[model samples]
Target: MIDEVVMLRHGRTQYNLQHRLQGQIDVPLDIVGQWQADQSGYALASRFYWAKVNRLATHPESIAQPPAAAAERTDINQYCEAPAAARRMVVISSDLFRAQQTAHAFADLLGLEVTCDARLRERSFGQWEGLTREQIKAIDAEAYASWKRHTGGETRYGVESRAQVGERGAKAVRELIQDPRYADDETSTTMMLVGHGSWITATIANLLELDPDGMNALGGMRNACWCRLKVRHTINGQPADRPLFELEEYNKAPAIADSADWENGPADLRGSSMPDWCPIIW
Candidate 1:
C-alpha cells in the first residue's frame, strides 16, 4: 500500500502574531508556539496507537502469534494481519527555522530523522515580506490590489506567482512519493512535510486537482494544523503516473474553553465588551 502523507504547517511565529508576511525569512517559534508543537506531537502519537488497535481488532487471529511470526506467515488466513508499528515513518521540512523546529517535534516523538529541503520553503513574498496587509495597502495600493485580484502582474514587485509556487511545491512532494525506497515497502509508512501555510495549502490543492479559484477559496492553514492525504494505487497494476491524492482529514486542534468571563465577573458590559484574552493557536 502507498504510504500516507501528512502535511503540517509550522507553529506560530512573531510575524504570525503581528499579521505580517513572513515569506522565506527565518523566525523561531514563540513560547505558546512551542506548546502547540508539543500538543501536535501528542496528537500524532495517539493516532499511531489508535491505528494499531484498530488493525488488531479487525484481525483477531493475527494477535495469537508474535509480531515476527506473523510477518513470516504466508497463509491466506493471515492476510489480514495487523500492520506492524510504523517504524519507518519519515519527516521532512523546509529549511526555514520555524518549519525545521516544528518538524523536529514530530521527529523527536517518533524517533525519526528529519530531512530539510529548500524546495519546501514558503513562497517568496519578494517585496511584500515583513509588511502587514494594511501597510501594503497604504504603501503600494496598486500592487496590493493586483495581488488580491490574483493577477499575474505582481512579478515586478518580487512576489512569486501563485501558479508557480503550487507547481514547484507539488513537484517536490511528488518526487518524495515516487522514491523507490518509500514505494517498495509493503508495510505502511508515513511521511510528514512541514512548511508555510500558503505554500502547503496550495500544494495540496494542486495534488487534489482543485481549480484555481477553488484553491483560493480553501483559505489559509492554521498553525500546527495538518491534512491527511491517502495515495491510491493505479488500477492497471502498473505504477501510477499520477497517484490519486484524496483528502482524508483536515485542520483539527485541541479544544480550548473561554475563561475570560469566569475571571471578569458577570457585569453585563454589552456594547463595551473587549475581545477575550485566550491565546489563539491558529
Candidate 2:
C-alpha cells in the first residue's frame, strides 16, 4: 500500500499571474513558477530520504566518496543508509503543461520519470474558461450567480459540475491505490500527485468520502503548495475500506514566513497575482 500521498499544486503561470481562468489550457510555468518548483523539489528531496538518494544517485562519485566531502553530502549520507527495499518513490502528474512542469522538477531532482494522467487535470470551466469572474458576470450574469451559489448543475457554457470533478479525482486516487504499477507490499512507497488547485482539493475530499460540495469549506490552496495524507491499506498492503485518507498536512509551503509579513497578508507578492475571479482563495 502507499504509505503517504503528497498532493502538490502546479506553480505560477502566465494565466495565474494575469488572474485569468486557466481551466484545461496547457499553460507553462512562468519564471517565478519555475523557481517555486525548483525550491519545492529541493525541499521534497530533503524530506524524503529516498528522494534524497535519488537526487544524489545521479552523481556516482558522491555515492562512492566518504561523507566528509561536504555538508550536503554529509546530510545525504545520514539518510542513504536505509535498505534498498525502502526507497520506492514515484511521481504522477496531470497532463497539463503547468502540472507537468512542476512534476518534472521533482522528477529531475529525484532521478525519476513522470507518469501523466488526464484524470488529474483541472476542472474545465467550459465557456467560462478564459474570462475573469467580472467578465463572466458581465457576459452571463445568471451562470456566474449560479456558480457562486452552487445551485445549478451547469454553468453558462456548460461548466463542469462539482460532482463530475469529484468523481474523476476520486477515480484517479482509486486507480493509484489499487493498480499494481503504483502500490505494492513495500511500506515505504511514497506517491506524489502534481495537479491543479481545484483538482487537488476535490481529490482529497473524495478520498475522505466527503459529499460533492464538502470541499467548499476548505478554501483554496496556494500555487506550489502541498498537502499530505496517510493511506490505510489491508494487512497485505492492498486497498482497504473507504476513508482511505487521514489528513496529515494541508496547504503548506516549504518555509514559514515571519509574522511581520502578515501585516499585509493578502498583499504578499507571493500570492498577489491571485484574481478575485479565481475560485482559489490562496
Candidate 3:
C-alpha cells in the first residue's frame, strides 16, 4: 500500500467569491484561483525535495546539521526548487472542473497526468447548488436548521447527505490506496487527490473510521490547501484488516503568505450569515 496520501482542495471559484454553495457545479477557477493553483503546484513539488533534504540533513554520515533547529528541516520557502518526486506518484482529481483544473497544475509540475474520478466530487446540494449563505437562510430556514443540527435521514431539497458523500469518497480512496500500480520497494511513493472542501472533509473523517456525526469535526480544507495522511497495510503479525489513516498535517497552504483565515465558511455558518473571515491568499 502507498505510505502517504495528500488530499488537496480545489482553488477558488466564482461561487467561492460570492460565498455560495457550489455543490457539484462544474465551475471554473477564477484568476486568483488559477494563480493559487500554479503556486500550489510549485509548493507540492517542493515537498518531495524538502523531504530528501531533511533525510540528508539528519544522517550521521552526511554533512553536519544546521545550527538552528528551525533551519534543519530544509526550507524551500522561496518556492523555486525543482520537484524531487517527478515520478512514482499517482495524481487523481474529482471530475468537477475546479478540482480537475487544480490537479492539472500540480500534475503538470510533477510530470504526471490527472486521473478524474466522480467519487471524489463535492457533496450535491440539490436545489441549493449555487445559493449564497444569506439566500439559503432566508429561503430554507427549516433545511438550514436541520443541516446545523446534523440530523440524519433528512436532506434539504434532496441534497446528498454528508454520510453518503463520505462513504463514497472513502471507498474510492481505499481502492486507490490498495492499487498495485503505486506500490514500490522505496515505500515513499505518494497519492495525491485534488477535490472539493466538503468532499475532502468527509473523506478524511471516513478514512479515520469516524461515523457520520464526526464527518466535519476536523473541518474542511481551504482552497488550494491540503492534508497529509499516513496509512500502514500491515501491523503486528497480520495484514491490517482495518487500516488507520493517521493525519500528519491538516489545512496547510504552503503557497499562501497567510493562511490563518483560509477556513470553509458554509460549513461553519450553521444556519447563520457568513462570517467576516476572508481568504488572504491573493
Which candidate wins on TM-score?
2
Better of 1 and 3 by lDDT: 3
Each candidate's lDDT (Cα)? Answer: 0.70, 0.73, 0.73
TM-score of 3: 0.75
TM-score of every model versus the real structure: 0.75, 0.79, 0.75
Model 1 segments more than 4 A misplaced: 49-83, 214-216, 236-238, 255-282
Pairs clashing in candidate 2? none
Q: Taking the tens digit of each residue's C-alpha lDDT, what string does model 1 give over 1-282? A: 446888888877778767788999889986556656666767775665544343444445545454674656445344344344333466789999999888887667645568898999998999889988888888877877777777754567798877678888889888888777555465566768888888887788778766544434566687887888987767577867677788887775544313323212234532253332233231
- Answer with 2 or 3, whichever has the higher TM-score: 2
Per residue, candidate 2 scores C-alpha lDDT tens digits across 1-282 of 677889999987878766678899889987667767776777776676566564354344555455566555434544445454345777899999899999988777656779999889999988878777778778877766777777763455867777678789888887886779877775467889999988887778767777656544456778788999987765456645642568899987766323322212233345655443234331
lDDT, candidate 3, at 257: 31
**TM-score for predicted model 2 compared with the true structure:** 0.79
Off by over 4 Å in 3: 49-87, 152-154, 181-188, 212-216, 259-282
lDDT tens digits by residue: candidate 3, 1-282: 477899988887878878788998899987667767767878887775444443333332443345675545544432223343223567889999999999988876645668888888899988888987568778867777677778842374878888888898999888887667756545456788899888888888878867667544776577898899987776876888855689998988864537433333323322344334365321
- C-alpha lDDT of residue 220 in model 1: 69
